[model samples]
Target: MQKILGLFLFGIVLLTNIEAKDYEIKMLDMDKKGHTMVFDPPFLQIQPGDTITFIPTHKSHFAQSKVIPDGAEHFLSPLDQKTTFQLNQEGVYLYVCPPHQMMNMVGIIQVGKAVNMQEIRSALPKLERKAMTNKGRFLEYAKQIQE
Candidate 1:
């Protein structure tokens, strides 16, 4: 009976430790309604161990990391394919679609905290004109996270 109780407690512990959740962001094309080639929910906040899946609902879209936290890994998804990235660090991550970068197809992810705000801010000026337009949105989201 004691052994069974121990096993049950272990199972409960394992379940409690698994806190990761999956989030989906869809890539959409420019349209008459002024969609402007963007990622739905361009900014997201998640915890370490959570995963984000970038889905290309429209053609010719992909996700590539443009800025990442120090000591964090960068990733690029294949064009027109769905890709998943796991956030393991407590900082900010910025990504963009290569072909539509000039059109400002961008996104920001905050994992646990905005620890890499300075790094992300410094990298914004390196982006092209259209891509820089998304900077305002990113900053707004970052501010929310900090608050």
Candidate 2:
């Protein structure tokens, strides 16, 4: 009976240790081209167990998950609405706008540790593909040009 009780207590501690951080992602004014896309801070730095809230003032904008080089579905926002998602692991999350991918309406969420832009740049192909698929042909061409 004592052993069972000890195991139960250990489980409780493990559960308590898992916590998530919350982030508020806001979309502000558009650029010169009148793109209704935006992301607060543009880039976010956070640790593991963090959450990001995407609040878009404009109803037409959307967020969606991008495709990582490893064939993973990175966090993506919905189009024309507000959304939120929690970061459960430590890694680089690349997100972009479904409508303004060409304008580079992109954002990054770094969790667990620090990630340099160079690392993210190296994996541009995958990111570009993911962006182009959601945004449009213009963004696809734009991503290729950057590389």
Candidate 3:
């Protein structure tokens, strides 16, 4: 009976995770909005366990995690290559392109609720300071975080 119960529980866990989804983001040099060095659709809302593929639509862009929820894994993709990141933890995730960071090549991925919004918010000032061209752009994305 004990062994049977353990197997049943494990099966239920797998079933719960079956609904996870996948998403995509583009690393762009310039978008229709006339912005440079940015992620197309710079802000994304997703659920925990979702996966995101960062495609380099232009060049010299990689998805590098800047801030993540505590216990969440950090990811950094190769520059100018397609890389996929799995978001397993719940909270807000911030990413940037190292080569064009000064041009404000940044983005946000909010998983579930903004469970770690305060921590992500506290880091915005530094992100803003590090930006050379698009001042206040980081905070602008942060403001879009709901709850």
Candidate 4:
């Protein structure tokens, strides 16, 4: 009986330690009704083990990583219906759609901490004009994480 109780408690602890979720980021057309030429939400805060599924609600849209945490892996979605990526690092991740990049279809994900903030800031200016517009927003989000 004691052994069985111990096993049950171990199972419960294992379940409690699994902290992962699937976040959705939709991609819309530039002419969409509600939101267009952008990633829905545009910004997200998640834990290190979280995953983000990028869904192209419209045609010709794909999510590609522009900047990621220093030791994190970069990702690029195929020009398909959806793409999912798991973030295992603790930092900021920036992504955009290739074809609609000029329209500023971009997004940022904050995982755990904004550790690579300086790199993200330095890389912002090199982005397109439309993407630069999001710099302030991203910086603001980063500040919140720092605090």
Candidate 5:
């Protein structure tokens, strides 16, 4: 009876577990929207514990974390390589493609909630300072966040 009860409890645990979701962002030379050196779906909203896979559909573009909530780790994937990021922090994340950031090749990710949006807001000017063109795109993406 004890062994049977343990097995039953294990089954219950498994059944109640919430599985993390997965998402993908493609690195493209140019998207249908006419943005160049950009990540497809440049704006994303995900719950905590979700995973984002950045796929380099075109060579020479990579994803690198630019700004994140305090204590969140920064990441940089090799150029033209695929990388996956497991986001457990409940805040905003800003990522960019180094070579093309000047072209406004950037992305925004809001995890769970924009907990640190205020902090990110303060840094937006610096982030956009590198964009030779399309600097206003940052504000455009920022506004997309409902919070």
Candidate 6:
């Protein structure tokens, strides 16, 4: 009887885990040339009920939204150490760094779908455009993060 009860408890735990989804974002450091960039895990996709944890192993890093084409929801970590952003949408997200925009520090997030490499690649230019234009709103958002 004890063996049967243990098996049932294990089954419940497994089922609970399947229902919860989680993801991670690692902000990488500068290369030999001192260019800070966001290392691509290539693709990070999740369902609506999922979370994305942005872990910056160093200072001077945060995440922001791409406004023009994708109009992705934005979230930035204050200069206060580590931060996490839980995703609650069902659309594609394109993000970039403000200070290092010229260096092409970009990333993509696709929610409720399998990893699509081409889709992510296509969105890269939008991020570049926003970075180059130094658009008022976007840059302001970054400044807020630093503040």
Off by over 4 Å in 5: 1-18
lDDT order, best first, reads 3, 5, 1, 4, 2, 6
lDDT of 5 by residue, 63-127 (tens): 88989988788878888778888888889999899899899899999998788978889888888
Q: Per-residue alpha-carbon lDDT of model 2 for 10-121, expressed as tens digits?
A: 9987875665557887765564445445565566766666678888865666666563323234666666567778676656666766676664566666665533335566
Against the reference, the lDDT scores of all candidates come to 0.80, 0.60, 0.87, 0.78, 0.87, 0.57
Candidate 3 global CA lDDT score: 0.87
Task: Please report, as a residue range, the 10-residue window in candidate 5 with the lowest summed lDDT.
Answer: 13-22
Give, for candidate 4, the lowest lDDT window spanning 10 residues. 132-141
Q: TM-scores of the models, in the given order?
A: 0.82, 0.60, 0.86, 0.79, 0.88, 0.59
Root-mean-square deviation of candidate 5: 2.3
Write one digit per residue (lDDT tens) for candidate 1, span 37-114. 888878888898889999888999999998888888998999999999888988988888889887778788888878
How do the residues 41-98 of candidate 3 rate in per-residue lDDT, one tens digit apiece?
8898899888999998998778889999999999999988998888989999998888
Query: What are the RMSD figures for all models against the true structure?
Result: 3.0, 7.4, 2.8, 3.4, 2.3, 9.1
TM-score, predicted candidate 3 vs. hidden true structure: 0.86
Model 4 agreement with the true structure over 34-135: per-residue lDDT tens digits = 545778767899988889999878789889898999889999999956888999999988888888777677778889878987888787656645553334
Local distance difference test, candidate 2: 0.60
Q: Which stretches of candidate 1 lie over 4 Å from their true place?
A: 1-9, 16-18, 30-33, 128-143
Q: Which tens-of-lDDT digit does each residue in 1-147 have in candidate 6?
A: 999999999999998678767676667665444545643342465666577777776567776766322333577766524666766665656676566566566665666642333554465545556554323322222222211
Q: State the displacement of the C-alpha of residue 101, model 4, in Å, after optimal TM-score superposition.
A: 0.7
User: Clashes in model 6: which pairs?
Assistant: none
- Compared with the true structure, model 6 gives a TM-score of 0.59
Ranking by TM-score: 5, 3, 1, 4, 2, 6
